[model samples]
Target: MDTTPQAYRPETAILDLGDAFYDPVTPANFPETHLRFRNDRAAAEVGLETLGGGEWIEHFGRFEPMPGSLVEPLALRYHGHQFRNYNPEIGDGRGFLFAQLRDTGDRLMDLATKGSGTTPWSRFGDGRLTLKGGMREVLATEMLEALGVPTSRSFSLIETGEQLERNDEPSPTRAAVLVRLSHSHIRIGTFQRLAYDRDADNMARLVGYVLRNLYAEEPGDDAAAQLLDRVVGRTATLAASYMAAGFVHGVLNTDNINVTGESFDYGPWRWAPTWDPAFTAAYFDHAGLYAFGRQPEAIHWNAMQLAVALRTVSEAQPLIDILETFPERYQRAVSEAILWRVGVVPLDSTRDRALVQAIEQGMTQSGIGIDRFFFDAFGGTVPADDAFAAARAALVGYTARKPRDHAYWSGAPCSMLIDEVEAIWSAIDQRNDWAPFHAKIAAIRHMGEALAD
Candidate 1:
């Protein structure tokens, strides 16, 4: 994993573990290659920013292998607990790991695809991704990055110009292909599959691979416990950041919990309209299992599942000890995230707790939109209404972290509320109008720059 970023340090390192973990597959050949989006920001990190439109289409849309990367795409194998029901038959049904490379930060990043084609795991379904779904994912990743959430970057999106029928969205919807850059594709369910098969050798092998490649951990007697601890902390921080950013990862299942702790696979994702904890993203979520407020609980439960799988190779007591630290870690991370969003230097634990309560209570009472609330509190002051008095009092002694003179502060905060999201998509769906979509991306990126430290 060379971190020097010299013309893309491509690697096929995942093959060292052999082909049992994934099946070599081919991508679908679409009738048309219509370019829709390209993320130059993400490409620059991996030294791929110089690709022309033809090269981009040739490599991403046509699925041609990048030189010195994976010779063939690998459809990864794993089983997951979908909505808490154990399903041992699920894996990368529609997508596959296309390539692996090192970025400028010395981190291992993966180039994977969605709606690319079908694979060995494509059970009873067409492995095509809807164009509208791809459009939504691009917007979701862009907005999440702007809001400072750790997430997979949407590197490329191309409309395939195919018509597919489905029950979820409008039938005969247009089709697309999506390429995302992520820290790691390894998930908790990856371990679950290994543990279920009782493949002790591969389990240990996979654990070592993760520890070295993702966690930068030394394979010692305590390596398993060490990796678990790091994962728990990262997951806690991710959950805390989501809460601060007002993100609801509609489907927080075990398979979706990447060991690196970045959020991805935006199916029914939504941002909270206000401070409503009961807001659901996926319409089928009648149980509220992965609602806004319960996200921390859902994340924690996924960590527990990881611990359960690691027990096959490590001591139970050490893993349990690490799991016990989630609550405190989550609380501290939440406080830090809130203070960061509020643009204030943090104080002691007691004051931070009071400030959290005050800000949340004020948000709940005032019904201010989440983005607007944070925007108005840029200098740690909201309206002078009595509902905000407690926040003002708790924020009295703190100093602002950054000056609020950026151009973004001169106007209302850019937001991704559901109606606006639909409007952006409807324009594309009805009239092929992409001006609104591109404009929103530009605004979101501007906001990200303004918020950058």
Candidate 2:
């Protein structure tokens, strides 16, 4: 084993917030370790590229503390309102924050695990992740990141030799563990937990910690309101990003929502097959509470819950004032995100909004696939078909972001529709073929790079 510490800038910032915020836990023992996936890009971010596959599995899968990193895995404590009902029992049941390191951008990033082990928060169920579940999250995160959503990157996945029973899918399936890299692991539920304990001083301390660490530019005197405002903006953009990408998060519980506004914790997530607003990802979401169209509402409601939690330390009216701006901010963000998706830069907000509305109407009336529409309509151009006539008219004055001579423009649009995701996984499950999965990831990354340029 390489005992030398790499260039990773490890920090115990979250741990410094005190033991009340988390509980140290032990990871479960798996009989075997087979590294399944490793995100090289994410590794480079933290300067961990020198660590080979064996070391990656040892640190991530075996739960061996990274050299010069946190001494013990911390299962973060938090409480969330599940589907709008307050639930004080929820926390990091199956996952824990393994380490914190700074990216090249000097931003704090967390390496959190899933299906690694059981913690005190594990309530009545085994703290294990199904291989299929890990596969789905890897796919979901890659696709979302490619689409430019502020989301967590799936870092490492390793098969843990275990067969676990599940109620949702095939029983006694293979098990695995996953690690995700994200901006922060702190959730709105973290504040709720503090509020539930009525720890006003701790609540105030947390607010200061977040402001100093996450939003270091902001003034500390009114940190609570400022944090809420920034969170609202980021959350609004998140909702709009989902709408533009045609994604339904399936579950938008406060615990699943990160305070830093990066989307993570994929469960039953799906892309809309079409432009239907009521499309849902989870099978049990009978009411479509977190449906494609209702995601903005769900996220805004979660922000409100954060505001409620902040009441333990700050004045309520200031927070409420920020909450009231969610609708306008979301509307603006949706228009901006839509324009970004179509590879067009905004010249006029009014014209862009009209174009967005026209595109939405065109998709709804023409029954075109959402991703296909954006793929075809890149560079502010519209299909010549009658179905897109309205959209074509709306884009008459708009300009493309740049020249559209990329080779990707000539290829079929990359999509993560349910059928495609399943096919990718099926190839691996049936014949141990990982080519399709890797090919899909490459294509997605290509699309992301092209968009970025």
Q: Per-candidate RMSD vs. true structure?
A: 1.9, 2.9
Provide the clashing-pair count of each candidate structure: 0, 0
lDDT of 1 by residue, 1-453 (tens): 644544678988788878879999989999999999999989989889988899999999999999999999999999888888989998999999999999887798999999999999999979999988998999999988987889999999999989999997788899999999999899999999998997878989888898888877778887778888989999999999999999998999999999999989999999998998898899999999999999999999999999998888888999999999999999999999888888888989889988998999998898888998999887688778788889888898998889988899999888888999999999999999999999999999999988877
Q: Please identify model 1 stretches exceeding 4 Å from their true place.
A: 1-6
CA deviation > 4 Å runs, candidate 2:
1-6
Put down candidate 2 lDDT per residue, 1-453, tens digits, no spaces. 654434688887887799989999999999999888899888988988788877888898898898777999999999999888899998999999999998877898899999987999999869999988898999899889988799999999899989998988777788999999999988999999998999998888888888778777544677789889989999999999999989999999999898888999998999998899889999988999999989999999999999999988889899999999999999899999999888888867778788899888888888888888889888888777787787888887677887678788879888999999889878977887889988988998888877774
Clashing pairs in 2: none
Q: What is the lDDT of candidate 1?
A: 0.91
TM-score for every candidate vs. truth?
A: 0.98, 0.97
Give the Cα lDDT of each candidate. 0.91, 0.89
Top model number, TM-score: 1
- Looking at candidate 1, the ten consecutive residues that score lowest on lDDT are 1-10
Error of 1 at 142 (Å): 0.9
